[model samples]
Target: GIKGQSLPDHYEIDSSKAKKDLGITFIPLKKTMEDLIVQLADLQTMLEQS
Candidate 1:
């Protein structure tokens, strides 16, 4: 039996206004995750050096 339970997903932010008013571009989830990983790694390295 599975111990962990899955929670229902929801959207917190409305993207339509960002696109129409702010001219923000949507990034793919995969690419966004990759970029976050890289940023975290860099931050860790900086912390270790300090």
Candidate 2:
């Protein structure tokens, strides 16, 4: 069976199951950019505090 959404971070999948069931995984470019932006902001705040 196919999954409608990606597995949560805490969940683990068997290697064999992943190889057979999940062909490919993709994250949206916008989400990736947003994550990077948040990370950069965190880093900037850390630098300012130091």
Candidate 3:
């Protein structure tokens, strides 16, 4: 999907059996964004240092 005025999109992801058997869980979006922000900030710092 594009940034703005995007068309509807979808993907095929099935871990249903795994979820049932292995009890896997998903991370929250807020935590994902926080981790991504930290990673990007670290990359930016490395670029500046270089």
lDDT tens readout by residue for model 2, 1-50:
46797766796655666656887556789999999999999999999999
Model 2 bad stretches (over 4 Å): 1-22
lDDT of 3 at 6: 62
Candidate 1, lDDT over the whole model: 0.91
Q: Quick one: best lDDT, which candidate? A: 1
lDDT of 2 at 3: 71
Better of 1 and 3 by TM-score: 3
Using lDDT as the yardstick, the better of models 1 and 3 is 1
Q: Per-residue lDDT for 1-50 in model 3, tens only? A: 56687665986889898889999988899999999999999999999999
Cα TM-score per model: 0.53, 0.53, 0.59
User: Poorest 10 consecutive residues of model 1 by lDDT?
Assistant: 1-10
**Candidates 2 and 3: which is better by lDDT?**
3
Which portions of model 3 show Cα errors greater than 4 Å?
1-17
Model 3 TM: 0.59
